[model samples]
Target chain A: MRNKFAEALYRLSRSDPRIHIVVADISPAGPMNEFRKEFPERFINVGVAEQSMIGICAGLALKGMLPFAYTIATFALYRPFEMVRDDLCYQNLPVTVVGIGGGVIYSTLGGTHYAQEDITIAGAIPNMSILAPCDPAEATAATEYLVGADRKGPCYLRFGKAGEPDITKDAIEPFRFGKLRYLRRGRDVAILSYGVTMGLAVKAAAALADKGKSVSVIGCPTVKPLDREGVIEVLRSHPRVVVAEENAPRGGLASEVKSVAWDIQARCALQTITLKDEFVHCYGSHEDLLAAHGLSVPAIVAAAGG
Target chain B: MSAAPRRLANDFDTTAARERCYRLRRRILDVSQHVSALHVAPAFSCMEIVDCIYHGLMRKDESGAYLDTFLMSKGHGCMTQYAILESHGTLPRSALDEYCTKDGLLGAHPDYGTPGIAASTGSLGHGLGMAVGMAVAERNAAKAKGRPVPTIYTVLSDGEVQEGSTWEAVMMASTLGVDNLVAVVDNNDFQSLGRTSETHPSFYPLVEKFQAFGWETVEVNGHDAGAVFRAVTARKGAGKPFMTVAKTVKGRGVKYMESVPIWHYRAPNPAEYKQALEILEKVQS
Candidate 1:
């Protein structure tokens, strides 16, 4: 799925002469091979330096060019948080930050590799718009919006690893940034998920339906702007809301929904199926980690029952 | 009001530039008194480097538009840049007088939207990478127009080199062979708390480190306006980016603050300002 998103980015770069891809040394892997092979002049490899990558992208934006900087989730944003805030966000430069492997996707690499709280840092910054697409199609749509000339400021696009099937259907309005995709409409229970957790949320909704529990799942790709109206509308109608994500609950979608729910005077039970506040010392496959951290489909079903 | 942009002739006016720098220091002192604090020692150390770049190195085209780009990568020393640009008549005097004040267009660091500032800096290690990006952009723009690549100048401080991003930019600049880029290091050897030499003894031999990374390196007396100007100008079309390590004192003109690290941030009071002005006045530029 990430490969499709990267391919879309490469294809977009081909059409727009103003578009450029700058990396902190992720070439010869993923879709970078194609980008570097065809557009060597436009593809810059900064050699594992995330801070320089952001600053360089800012510089390119200042020169009337658009730059997409790519790197792993943890190394990409956390290492250069200050640069992202000061250089890209402060200047409000049109640099698209393509962060791959969000929310424990880097399983088996230990805690250092996990990028759980990327949204928290990115969402907190001023003049920054954030998106975490559920699958490749949504990722491509988000990428197109970011590279578009209409984007007013810096954007962070977080992607879960490849091979997650599309949790969204075509009948839903085509992917638009800052708009939520309503996967199902139901009363009594509203389950909101961002990024890869959408698949689990959908599966959980189906299980709860079999048990005669009415459930609706909403996939929120753009977490920062958050489609405030859409969220408020959902809260107004629903009696129970459960926020699900494969990230820390403190600053992830759960916290954001609660912040919105508190002032709206909505009467709903709030439950979050996310990682605990502590670091995960255990190492395993992606599924094993998710299950151990209580982010599996069963966990979603249980949380939805609330 | 912002001054009208003008393409002043760059014939290497040494005497006039030297005199301007001297007076610029005094002017910075005057402005520093009004503000709660300014980076006086940092500004003093890199005063001539900023002057040399703005006066001797920058190339402005006929339309009074600047063709070249410069970034104060060591942004804490922006007072030096503001002082020099103000002296060159490109910046309004009111901007300098109200610097770092509530209504000042100027602040402790260089901001992009302000008049004549190329990039917002003062965040350590951002300027060099930005300059590299600017150089690459200039190359692409030149290729589009079938013209020469415009030079991009960035002034870095010795302490700023400690940031890993600085070395990352150096690696990329050499790999790309960005000959249009030139970096001037205001090597006064002081960090925020103390001398970099005493705090981190292993960080020396900057010339060799930059050369090892494939930069055309040079060393000079940073205080000498003529020497700083010559070292930068000599690197034109050198087939690689150039770096000048200007060995200097932390406080170049003042009596008590020379080589002192506390003055890196601490501004002079009225009495100290008077004594420093007397010492600065006696220097023969």
Candidate 2:
């Protein structure tokens, strides 16, 4: 996912001169060396100053450049929340905030490093848009879309680290930034998933299909605008609706679904297979954290019963 | 000790500008009178710093199409900028009359959509970081177009520097060697309820702090617009940025409220307003 973001940025930057990448010491560590080697001038390395990095991007955006300030998820948004809100969101600048290794991707890095609140925080911001591509292919597509996006407002791009395969059937087609894409077609239950958990959701959907329960998988890319119509469609159609994400249920995709889907009502059951409000104190790989918190495929399958 | 150049004795009319500063104070007092409450002392402390920047170095057109950019990092003192901008004809006289009202153009803090405001700031410790950003963008855009980089200026409050983000910005500015950026700290001794000096004296001797962080530093009488302008416009090597420490008095023209903390948020009563007006009106010459 990191390499996809770097490559996508490189590809888009080749055509768009306004695309500038601002990093706070992520150059030497992240997959930005390709971009750093090519456009060293455009690639600004602010050197471990997250707050300054955000401000610099807002400044660059104000100067008619589309700046993508990249770093670890928490450091990029959580640490510099005010800069993102006031300098970028409040001004409604054309700044793309790419937060790498989102959710529990940085497993061993502990609770401080994990990004469980990105989508929620991004959603709360008035002029902010959010896109969490489930896989590298969609990550590339989301990058191209946001960089070329017509809206010149603040956008937060949250995606997981590399090595995950495509979870959706159509991974490389033209994608509308704020529209929800269908991953699998079914009838009994609707699985609305965001970020890496879409992989889990797809697996759960397949498991339910084997059990004669048809589950439709909806891929949520732009969770802020939230594909509200799509959420309402699923909520109103399916007998069971399962909203899944790597974030706490309170402010993640589930909360957004509820905001637009609750009053409309589902036919039978409404459940959220999401991270518990408590911290993931136990750590191993990213998958281990997700599994321990009942987001395992079996748990999701059981939650979306026949 | 700025080592850039000093024109402390330049022909920038101290008498005339000081008189304008007095008029600016009266205008600010009048505008704040309409609003039930105002950040009077905080605004007064940085009035001349803002006035000198707008009237002295930033002689750009209203379009701001060039490299000269200014952001009020000390956004609470925006009444000073609003009043000065009106005096400069950048902002219309109507903005002052509608201040803090529901239908008003102006608010407690300066918003970017408002004329003469570069960034929305009321959140302390946010402006300098953004100023550094604007400086970098201006330089980058200029470099892309083969033009000379534009200079960036921002004014900050004494209490605002207490935030760690300010030091973070300072360190990053020095590291980047952003020569085109100039920052003026409105170092009034008082903060909200206490003397900033007594609250955190450790941050004092602020000149050494900037120099240690690799910036060209200077100290000036903040009320002296000539000194403030001279410090900002000084010619220094184009390697590191510049920060000028402008020592000032809170509630400067209002004798009774000078350095008084309550005046930071409280509006003056009718008699107090009359006395303040009398203090400023005497300087019409």
Residue pairs with backbone atoms closer than 3 Å in model 2 (clashes)? A1-A162
Interface RMSD of each: 0.8, 1.3
For residues B1-285, what per-residue lDDT tens digits would candidate 1 score against the true structure? Answer: 111123333456777867887888898889878876889989988888888888777777999777888899998998998887786677899998888778878888999888788899888989988888888887777776787678888999998899998998898888878888889999998887787888998998889999999999999988777887767765644468889999988878886988887787887888998898888842333
Candidate 1 per-residue C-alpha lDDT over A1-306 given as tens digits, one digit per residue, 9 for 90 to 100: 678777888888787766778887775466767888888888888877888898888888888888988888887799998889899998888888888887788888889988877888788899998889888788888888887766778988888777888766542556788888787888978888888878888888889899888887888988878898888888887888888877786776788788888889777787777887778778887778888888888887887773
DockQ of 1: 0.70
TM for chain B in all models? 0.92, 0.91
Candidate that scores best on DockQ: 1
Q: Candidate 2: which docking quality band?
A: medium
**TM-scores of the models, in the given order?**
0.94, 0.94
Model 2: per-residue Cα lDDT over B160-251, one tens digit each: 88898888889988887788788999888888768867877787889999999999999999988887777676657468899899989888
For candidate 1, the per-residue lDDT at B256 reads 93
The DockQ values of the predictions, listed in order, are 0.70, 0.65
List candidate 2 stretches off by more than 4 Å.
A27-31, A169-174, B1-11, B61-67, B281-285
